[model samples]
Target: MKALYQYIKVIIQAFSSLLNGLLLTLKYFLTPGKSIITEQYPENRTTSIRIPERFAGELVLPHNENNEHKCTACTLCQLSCPNGSIEIFSKTIETEDGKKKKILDRWVYHLDMCTFCGQCVDACPSDAIQMKNNFELSAFDRNTLTRQLNRPDSRLEESNKQQKNTLAS
Candidate 1:
């Protein structure tokens, strides 16, 4: 008898909640200012919802004179890379200060492999790495899209670094 009474009570509560929901839904339907907030996909993608300021973005490399990239191949970025996207080749050299220092041999930054976690930027002690807002990174062929920018003798490569340096300076 007690279980039957509890079951009846639950049924009544459930119906009551259902009716209340329907009433509220109907009230919204009948309200003067009520309007649909749904956006049309693709076409309405231009509309903005506020993104936080500290959002991680695409990577940016600092540059120096002679259009060389500013990174000394310190490998701090490589160490901090969560996805192992940045591969560096560095050589030991004697600087003007008469001490052994690591000079950057080559910076192989794989654009396709990056997760854009911004850990590299944060770990870079020389301010060599930064993040930019470039988000459109689609490609037809995956292999064709994995870019190793700043090849040794590429004009576009040097010019790109130089442009960044000029802007920074």
Candidate 2:
């Protein structure tokens, strides 16, 4: 009789679980529109979707109209990158006062290898790097993934230039 009772209890529990699952399905079926949490992706591409500010999309080096940037080529960002995504090439130049100093030549960023961990941005002491909101980073060739962060004609900021000049003098 105890074995029979146990069998009955197991049956009852199975039915209860089935009923709970059915009730959840019915709840969604009854109000399908209200229960939808997913967006129709490609169809809604024309519509603008809001992305949060904190979203880590892509790294960008902000440049002003004067073609100036704040990166001092300290290589902190490159050092902080775990995947070796950042490569900074600097050139030593002679100042107006005949003093030699290192200046940033190119800042190579490998987007394909980047994990979007934001370590490089956090490690940048000069606040030269930041994450931009642009998420559309598709490319046909992998070579396009590797980009130069600094503009070809960009130079250090005027304050940095002045400081370097002072140090040279």
Candidate 3:
């Protein structure tokens, strides 16, 4: 009798689980307009479809109107990268006061090797880098995926220069 009771209990639990799943399916079927989970990418590509702000689509180093960036060549982002996707090359130059300081030369970003993990952005103390929502990253050639974040001849931002001057003094 105990064995039969145990078997019946198991069957009832299984049936309950099945019923719950079926109910969920029925609810979704009945409320198709409310249960939109997937976006029609091709059709909605040019539409006003909004990508969420938190989406880590592409890493970018933003520049100001003067073509200046805030990277101080601190190497914190490079050190924190788990996949070695970010390579920073800095050059030391003497400031007006003859103080030698390091500045960003080339910020090579290997998009092919990147896992879209925002660890590098979070590790940066200077807030030099951030992830942008422009996710059209498909490339025909692999070499095109490798990008340099800092533009040629770009220097540090004016505010950062002021901060450095204050710290130097």
Top of the candidates by lDDT: 3
For model 1, the stretches where C-alpha displacement exceeds 4 angstroms are: 1-53, 64-68, 93-101, 149-169
The total of clashing pairs for model 1 equals 0
Clashing pairs in 2: none
TM-score of each: 0.56, 0.79, 0.77
- Give the higher-TM-score candidate: 1 or 2: 2
lDDT of candidate 2 at residue 7, scale 0 to 100: 100
Computed on alpha carbons, the lDDT of every model, listed in order, comes to: 0.69, 0.90, 0.91
Q: Across residues 71-144, which tens digit of lDDT does each residue of candidate 2 receive?
A: 88889999999999999999999979997879999999999999999999999877889999878898999999
- The C-alpha stretches of model 3 lying farther than 4 A from their native spots are 1-19, 30-38, 46-48, 95-97, 165-169
Q: State, as a TM-score between 0 and 1, how close model 3 is to the true structure.
A: 0.77
On lDDT, who's better, 1 or 2? 2
Which candidate number has the best TM-score?
Answer: 2
Ranking by lDDT: 3, 2, 1
